[model samples]
Target chain A: MNSQNVFMGENLQELTVHGKKEFPIQYYADELFRLPGCQFPLHWHTEIEFFAARGGSIKAQIGRLEFLLEEGDGVFVNSNVLHSFSQLRPEDRCRCPNVVFSGELIAPADHLIYQKYIGPLLSSRQLPCVILKPSIPWQNSILSCLDRLFSLMQKHALKEERRPLPLLSFDSPADDIPCWEMQVQNELNRIWQLLISHAGEIPPVNIEKGEASLQIRMQKMLAFIRSHYASPVSLDEIAASASISKSEASRCFQAYMNQPPVSYLLDFRLEKAKQLLSSTPDTVEEISRKCGFRSSGYFCRIFKRRTGASPNQYRRETT
Target chain B: MNSQNVFMGENLQELTVHGKKEFPIQYYADELFRLPGCQFPLHWHTEIEFFAARGGSIKAQIGRLEFLLEEGDGVFVNSNVLHSFSQLRPEDRCRCPNVVFSGELIAPADHLIYQKYIGPLLSSRQLPCVILKPSIPWQNSILSCLDRLFSLMQKHALKEERRPLPLLSFDSPADDIPCWEMQVQNELNRIWQLLISHAGEIPPVNIEKGEASLQIRMQKMLAFIRSHYASPVSLDEIAASASISKSEASRCFQAYMNQPPVSYLLDFRLEKAKQLLSSTPDTVEEISRKCGFRSSGYFCRIFKRRTGASPNQYRRETT
Candidate 1:
């Protein structure tokens, strides 16, 4: 990926679409311990997402809100909200299976059902994220539907990404895929209505001016780092791109992303180096210098420590 | 139900809504032999409908088309199509479970999903009704969804006529209801997409100017009968209402409705008497007079023979 173009030239908003436009959803069975640094980086997209913690506890940080979601518990993160999840303890060995989807999967924006029930809930200043638990009845219903939804996706949805699920047509000749599209839709509808019914009790997220602007500033800084990750990136330059002081940029990252600005820069650099190693036949020293690392030895140490594999080992396994 | 009003007098359109407007759908587990005269008269409504025959064979007459649908066989009637079901043979005991719903129940008219997919199919001149048999794979998929939908409705929907199924609300406090709304919607969506995929294989019903006019003339004649059934309607007047000869009118009725005009009037009269018997304090003679039967004794005989109950016995049992 070209660093400047792939970063969208400081467009700031995350450009990764969760699923295909026709039937927009991506079902994930994520093992947290398997991910880099035992956590995926904080990112925000236009699509909404739901994460159900499984096997062990995990801490979900959405915007400025942070909470522990245990097994049998889940969380709903609203659209355009920056969020991340990580193990509660370093060795938690958690699994957090989830789905990320555009709202259009359930109802188009012009639909009456969307206008009456869905629009208000989505645009409300109060609900950036809602934590779900089995103790509550309505929340339990939502979680139960999520469970059923995951199972439905696992059963019928092909492992291939971005293709339309073989829901109805005999064209693809996958007989195991029954009429799953509609069944999954039915579960989603129930979950949405459950959220509607509890709109009042869920506290407002306080995405007032201060928090919203902080998120914008954070995005600009991240965009700057992404565009410049192939070269040396400093906190001073990142802060200058967002027109904020270096300390303010650090505060913005900490507030919305639950990490410091330098830590993010390091992660981005390491991520870019891994991409180069996997996609290109470049030497280790060449990749390390191109990814803004001080030395190939330091790069290899950090890569092995974070990913539990040497660069050559990763390339061999993946290639 | 008033005779003139219940008949929707000269409107020619059936006015009985299958379900509520907000969430429109009505489910029926119809035992064919229990229905008067072993059939319902030809009726046309704007909403679409689906029926799966169980236990024995029954013939479906849709517009000018007629076919036998056996157990594990189903049919889909498009919007505004006139259709009816009857025992293939009088002794063939059968149960035809079905759902009647407006197109809006599946997708709002303005949605892209509706405009791109659902609208074309419902308004297709080629597909008045589709027969589904378990022998074909795609057809069997649709039939399986119908089976699943019926079972979902049976489990989650209250026995009440028009109430919204207990889809998500805890307000009504029925503990057994789960998230069934989306599951049923999923099945319906798959069924719709299957029809779309098989659009080429399905033959158009030849609803050309000739056939369309035949249906219109038939409707006008039925409307005439609906308006005048309680006042001793004659075949001649029925023919004159739509400016056709008596024989042409009989042919039109048989061609579209699968029965003669006099039989329609007779069944309609019996239907009116049954309503009056159940809803009014009138004596059997009074109902017979109101429904334009020749005499109370003649009315009683016809009612007992058609419905397996005398007028007085039906009234007493119902009241």
Candidate 2:
């Protein structure tokens, strides 16, 4: 938080531009919104950050490049890179649970296991950044470890802050906390034990059954539109496939799929047309026919309006 | 590319995997496919992978979860995460240019600079997994470094792979070809130069201007649909804001955006209704009105069709 140290142990605390937190480990979880949206602006400090967006989208700009992030995706930004986040839409926004403990907060480098794996990976890449999407089988273990790390940090925080408390025993002062580091180490052991336990068994199915049903419907709809969109197909036709009425189809389409029947059909057609345009090097007229567009001029207008570039321009730029 | 040990030396003289190449150093750039429509199976390896989706949509399933990746979005799947990828649409698939080199491939760990930063972060967190989205300013640099790494890898591959007929030198028998390790080292130097030069600058903008325009339009369209879908918003209303004609708008909606106008609007409305139905303890009729559905019967039908479970069931399960 200060010039000498942007992040200091709360007991040996210092505060700065990132705002203030009195906790032992300044938890970034509750305060992530301060950065807002998904992208983070140019900024760097000595604190190590753990970022995970379980749902939604995130984009970060570090220098000139921008990196798009999706749910269950995250990256480790070494203290060296200046970075910032851009806000995302309400629908697109996601909650990324993370904790930031100063790099200097834990035991020295020699004691950590991450050094064996993460250490070499980071060093070999020569990249100031490391991005990660923990696989499902690894998610629980990873999250559990992080959760423990947070608790450990919290435990230490209490000791550092020396919060006043009444003692049960008549021995020693009530203000003193029992061995905090040992507790944290125990937490780390529990996390490791959980990870070892869940090493390879198939990951748990977390999406609800109803959500699964909706997902199935979405796939069916997508397949149907991809196959029959070019030819005339009505809402009723698609609905019949899902064994539902036209109106019912409309509601399902909106909630989980993000588009209704007719709209999805159009998307299928347009996407097909774009494929022809980008890969085949075909003319607008030719692509229109292949994509089920009736008129060449109409197709060109559509391509331009949607893509902000003519078919020809898109091909040229890409090729 | 070998498992046990990767040997890098002069191009010609190589045999055993672990056997060191005679020359000082050797660099090889393996050509990664740039297929826009190809899909890779779920897999993992010991080496670190840098994945970048240049265009369209790519969904990767690692562990138990699925991630929908767009352009410029990437995930670092550490070793042991079982993963697979699929192209949502033939045209929606794109190539990712990545550099794969071993920790032993570059400098020894002791001399690496990045090790200094990552060591502290990992040891401090004691986390089993960490995901990060770099802030702006840092993104560009990381991207540029990756870009340079890939470029150098390619150039090195060429030098190692191609050898012009050796000039007739009056030295020993023609079998003696001087080691190309020096050449590879030189190439690595060139890569380092590029990285150093661009280290202070923003990384390359991976998304094309045209692509950004389309994305911006998509963002606006999404906002419009979210805001006005409740009432009745025509195709004209959506297209007008994006500055396109109705038919053209349809194409835009279909293409990159992945849905048609009315259908998307309807879908959005229905989804809102579903959320309300599940979250709020409201009458079905009230929920229907809140979600823009006309009648309870219609809402029920749509909900049932989209979700095999009725609204009530969904609410119960969710609650």
Candidate 3:
């Protein structure tokens, strides 16, 4: 595989494991082993994930907690809880990106992922969502489970060689459940099975259920801005869509997020620009266009202001 | 002493070395023994500091650079650059916090603190900001420099006790430069020299050239909300105090921050309430009032919807 493609890949939709379809989910050693220095954004998938530092250490941030993982230590993040990971250590040997896929490569419901796993994890502050240094026994068992899950995923992928359609289904319910690593494994596997058995559709987003108020309307507006951040969005258009007066929309937004809606849009665009700069060798004009800046000059100015270095200087320094 | 107060202690006015009132400069270390597991936040003081971790590993985010502090590794951050640090390995010990105070602290412009050390370090992208393990010859010298600097600062603190008044009254230019640590033992000896020379007073918050928008008005609004969240904060009142038209203020806020000003207020309040529920032993009603919720019932409904758990349930589960 081209190493550069791994870093600069844009078609995030088509990633797969072995032969079976890959959906974002729980931790597997194989996936981690497959790619080195991989990173993911702050997001939640339909499957629970445990992050472990195999060789060196990895830093995982979930909500307020930040975990610095040593070898054999792991943090189990439940489904639909926002999280991000990075490995910024020098002595690390196994620097493969750690990610697990939810079983919903066949069918998915975002809510099930959240309700069953994330809800429980979040509700139970008792179980440190951010855990480190598991007992040797527990670590070995968890590692074994991860290996088996990886093998199973590989087996499903191998089936594609024999049958272009659905692969041979495993019958035993005992076999259906992935072996227990932690108590969470059972629920995690169950949700995975559900998602796997019925994967192939986008889940509905959450709806705000409250009295019709200016604030509630504003939340919808904010969500819209987040969803359409990649595209060119306008205040009048957003105001009309959110069914509020332009002035009122602007007012409500400023009061909540601290900046004007347009300014937020600009900031978000600039953030994307910075990301592209570091991760990809995209040109200033291209980045600006992608980020919806009206002019490269404006983009450069904002970029420099936000980050002391210019876009080009930053790209050169990092890349 | 309250452990939690470690972060806010003494209002450490400026960075110093050996308590002498001079500008802060970066120190390079060749052994991890002196600087291990140095975890710090991304904040800058008047002085610029550089830290090179030797024979140990660290991970630091210096501005945009996510540095892997390998042996002989170092990263130099500009004064007031917000950054954070974490240990990379189990063996790495915590490094002491580094600071770079302003040249205006005691010395003249073009002083060694800013010119000789930081100049070369900042410009060189090839040099690792943090060293993991330094080569043989450079290690001893670097360690000695750091060790002496530490002792010098300690000595300077001692001077503060013996001579509280007229502390900066040393007459001779020769006395201005001492041979305590490194090359600038003289400047390092001016412990509280600037503060002692001038009467006790906080420097006015000046608008620095090329500084980002003060964010003063926004901060004031947020602070007001935080302090009096339980009380009513009308849009007109907030706008009047901030010196902006209510509509303009709201629009500016929304355009920049993405949420309506009101929703932001609600969310910030709710977030605090959630934290209190998790961290403190307060009752739901008490938390509700403290968090600015209209009533316990309203708080419960909103809390449940936002967090998928009741306040009591959340508290119980978290605690």
Best by TM-score: 1
**For residues A1-319, what per-residue lDDT tens digits would candidate 1 score against the true structure?**
0122233334576665555566677776666676666675577777778888876888888887778888778999988777778877767766666788766667666544556566666776567899998999999889888887877665555454434322321112323433466556667887886887677777666566777777777777877787787777778999999899988888888777658888878877877777788889999999999888988999999999988999999888877
lDDT of candidate 2 over B1-319, digit per residue (tens): 2211111111211122321322222222211232212445323333334555454666665443466766555444433233445565664424455433332222223422224322222222122121212344444344444454444434443345562311211111211212222222223333333333333352332333354355345545655665565566778888887777888778766654346877766766665666676668998788877666767898899889876888888888877
Give candidates' CA RMSD values in order: 10.2, 37.9, 33.3
* lDDT tens digits, residue span A51-140, model 3: 555555666655334567765565556543445555555444443323354433211223233344334444443332435244544444
lDDT of 2 by residue, A133-194 (tens): 55654554555555555544444443454633211111112222233333333333343333
Judge candidate 1 against the unseen true structure and give its global Cα lDDT, from 0 to 1: 0.73
DockQ of 2: 0.01
lDDT of 1 by residue, B74-183 (tens): 99998877777877777876666688877666666754456667788788777889989899898988887887777766555545445433232111232243335545
Instruction: Please report how far candidate 2 places residue B44 from its true position, in Å.
Output: 29
Off by over 4 Å in 1: A1-11, A159-177, A203-209, A231-237, A240-243, A258-263, A285-319, B1-61, B64-76, B84-104, B107-254, B257-319
Per-prediction TM-score: 0.59, 0.24, 0.29
In terms of TM-score, how similar is model 2 to the real structure?
0.24
Q: For candidate 1, what is the DockQ-based docking class?
A: incorrect
lDDT of each: 0.73, 0.47, 0.47
